[model samples]
Target: MQFIGPDLKGASPMNPTYIEQLFVKYAKINTRSDPARSATPTTPGQTELAQLIATDLKTLGMSDVQLNPANGYVTARLPSNTARKVSAIGFIAHLDTADFNAENIQPIVHPNYDGQDIRLPGATISVAQFPIFKTLKGQRLITSDGTTLLGVDDKAGIAEIMGAMQYLLAHPEIQHGDVAIGFGPDEEIGKGAKQFDAEQFHTAFAYTLDNGRPGDIEFETFNAAQATITIDGTAVHPGNAYHTLVNAIGIAQQLLNHFPENDVPEQSQNHEGFFLINQISGTVAHAEIDVIIRDFDDAKFEQRKQWLIETIATMNQQLDQPRIQYTLHDQYHNIGTAIATIPEIRELPLKVYRDMGLTPNIVPFRGGTDGNFITQKGIPTPNLFNGGGNYHGPYEFITVEEMVTAAEVVARMIIAHGA
Candidate 1:
C-alpha cells in the first residue's frame, strides 16, 4: 500500500504544513478505543489507522515496515545513514483516542488566534477558563467542532513523529542513527503496550510521544490500580419493605460517601493522589461501583489502596454480612524509579531541548501512559510532549507551530544520538 495524501517529498523539517495536514487527516479517523472490549486494539478503527500509518511510513522510504494486526502495532525502521555505529532509538505513539465522542471529527482551524473566547456549537474555548490560550496568541489553533474530542492526545504525537521521520528521509545529509517507529492501539484503555515486543522494537531506549504541552518531558507517572465494588441486597414489596428489604443502591452510596470527597480528581493537583469513583450502576437488589486509585509516591499509592480495602471491610462489617465484594488489581507503577537509575534517558532530551533554546519542563504526570508498562518491561521509555491542551474533551486544541517544534525536538534527539 502506498501513502495517500499531499506530496511531502522535499518538505523542510521546520515547515509544519504537512504536519498540520496529517493531524487533520488522522484526527478525522474514528479510532476511539472500547474498554469493555477484551480484544487487542479493542476496536476496528485502530487497526485501520495502524495500516494507514504503515502505508505512510513505507511511502516515506522507511525500511522494514511491518504492521501486526494481532497487536495493532505498526512498526518501521529508518536505517542509519551515519558511519558510526550508534545505539538505535525508538519513537512510539498510540493509535487509539480516549473514550469520548470521536466520530466525524470536524477540525476547526483558527488562524492567527487572538486571545479571546472562541465559541463553537455547544462549547467555548475561553481564555479565562484556560489561561494557556493567552500564550497561543498569533498562532494557528486547531480544535474539534465542540461535538467531539480533537483526538490530538496522541495523533499529534503520531504526526510529529511521522514528520520527523519524513524530514530525516528527505534530508539524507542529516546524520542520524537507526530510528524505529511504533504505533500501537488500545493505549487509551491501558492495554496498548502490554504485549509490545521489546526484542522486535530493537532499541536501547524509547520515548512515548503521548504527553501534552510544549517543552514538557515526563518520566514520572501515577501508580495506578482499578477496584470494582459489588453489593447484594434482598428485594421485597414496597409496602412490606419495613425491615426485611435492603436497598443495595443506598449501601453503594454509603460506601462512596466514605471516600474523602476533598481528595478526588477535581480537587487534587500536582503530586497529590486521589480516589476516583468513575462509574456507578445499581438497583434495589444489586449495585456496583468502579473506582481507580492513583498516586505518584510508592508508599502513598499503597496507602490509597489500603484505604479502599479498609473501607470495604468496614462496609461489610456494618451490614453484618459479606454483601460487598470487591476485586482490586494493580495496573501500572510509576516510571520515575526506573528512569532514576539511567540518567541518560532523561538527560538526553533535556540536552536536546536546551540546545534548541527551549526550556525543558520536567513534570510529574498525573496519569499513566504506555511508557508505564513499557518501562516495566525493561525498556526505560519516558514521555515527550505532543503540544496540545485540554485533551480528552471537546475543548482540546493544538497549534501547528507547537507540533512543528515537537517534530524538531524528535529530529534533534536522533541527531544527538548519532553524534
Candidate 2:
C-alpha cells in the first residue's frame, strides 16, 4: 500500500486544515489489532505505527521516549514550565484500528459539505444511511470510499493528541504542568491496556480521546461480559433416529427462546440492557454457543449473566443428557464511580469547553473505553470525542472542523488542569 501525502500547507494546530492533515496521516496507515494473537500488539502493523508515533514525539522535543517491548506501548513526557506546581495530566489514544478490513482506505474530502447525501467514488458512504450528516452543513468532512473502515474510532484521537502537543511546544509561554502521552495496541479486542505501564508513565489523571461525535464528555460506560456454552449429543442413523437421537441444534434454539426478544440490541436503547447471541455452531454430537451481555447498571449486568447460566441448566434437564458446560468472562466496567469521587477531573474539561463558547454534551457510553480500565487502575480518566461518527465500519467519517475544535479543547483542558 502506498502512503497518502497529507497536505499541511495551510493547516495550523487549531484549524481544520491542520487537523485534516493529521487525520489523513493516521488514516492512511493500516494497523488492525488482532484478538486471536498472543503477542502484545497482536499485529505487526501496530508495532510499526507505534514506532512512527515515537519518532514524531522525539522530533517534537518530547523527552523520555520509552516503547514497551511486550505490547508495543509508547510513552513520552512534556515537562511543565508553570511557576506553581500542578498535578501531572495524561492524554491517551490507541494505535491500532479495528479487526475490520483495511486494504485501501480512500478518504474523500467534502470541502464545505452542503449537508446533503455524499456520494463517494464508490457506494461506501451515503447521507441517506447516516442522518447525522444533516447537522454538519458548511463543515469540511472526511469519509472513506466505503472499501475499508475509516479508522477514526481512535486514530482521530491519536491525531488530536499529537496536534495539541505540537501547539503547546510552539507556544511554551502557556502555563501548564507535566503532560504524559500514551499510545496502546489491541484496544479493539479489549486488550489494549492490559500491558500498559501505569507506574512508569505516571500521571494523576488521564483522558482517552476515543469516542463519537463532538462535545461528548463521557464518564460512564456499559459493564460488559461474554458467555460460552457447549452441548453434546449422540448421532444415530436417520432411519432409527426417531427417539434415540438428540438434535443439539434444537437444544441451542431452546436456549435462544429463553432470552426475551425485546431485550436484544436492535430493540434496546438508553439504559436498557441486552443479551446478544453473537455466534453459534452445533451438530448432533457437538455444539457451541457464544453470547455477549451489556448493561450500565452492575446489578442488571450480573443478572443478565446469571440468566445465561440458569438457561444452560434448564436446557440440560430438558435434553436429559446433562452434557452442557458454560463459561463466563468479564471484560470491563463503567467509570462513573471513579469520576464521581474526583469531580474536579470530570468538571474541568466541560468548564474549559463551555468557556470557549462550545456546548458540552454529557452522554452515557453504551460501550466500554480504555478510560474505563484506567479509571479503575487509580488514574482519573474519562472518554472524549474526536469528531467522528459511525466508527468501526466503512461508513465512518470525521469532520475537519470537529477535529480542529477537539485540538483546541484538549489544549484548553491541559491549561486549565495546570492552573
lDDT for each candidate structure? 0.88, 0.81
lDDT of residue 380 for candidate 1: 84
Judge candidate 2 against the unseen true structure and give its global Cα lDDT, from 0 to 1.
0.81
- Residue 145 local lDDT, model 2: 86
**Predicted structure 1: clash tally:** 0
Weakest 10 consecutive residues of candidate 2 by summed lDDT: 1-10
**Which lDDT value does model 1 have at 226?**
95
TM-score, predicted candidate 2 vs. hidden true structure: 0.90
lDDT by residue for model 1 over 40-64, one digit each (tens)? 8898888888888888888879999
lDDT string for model 2 (137-239, tens) is 8888888887788889788988888888877887777778899989999888878786777888789889999966777888788898988888887789879
Candidate that would win on lDDT: 1
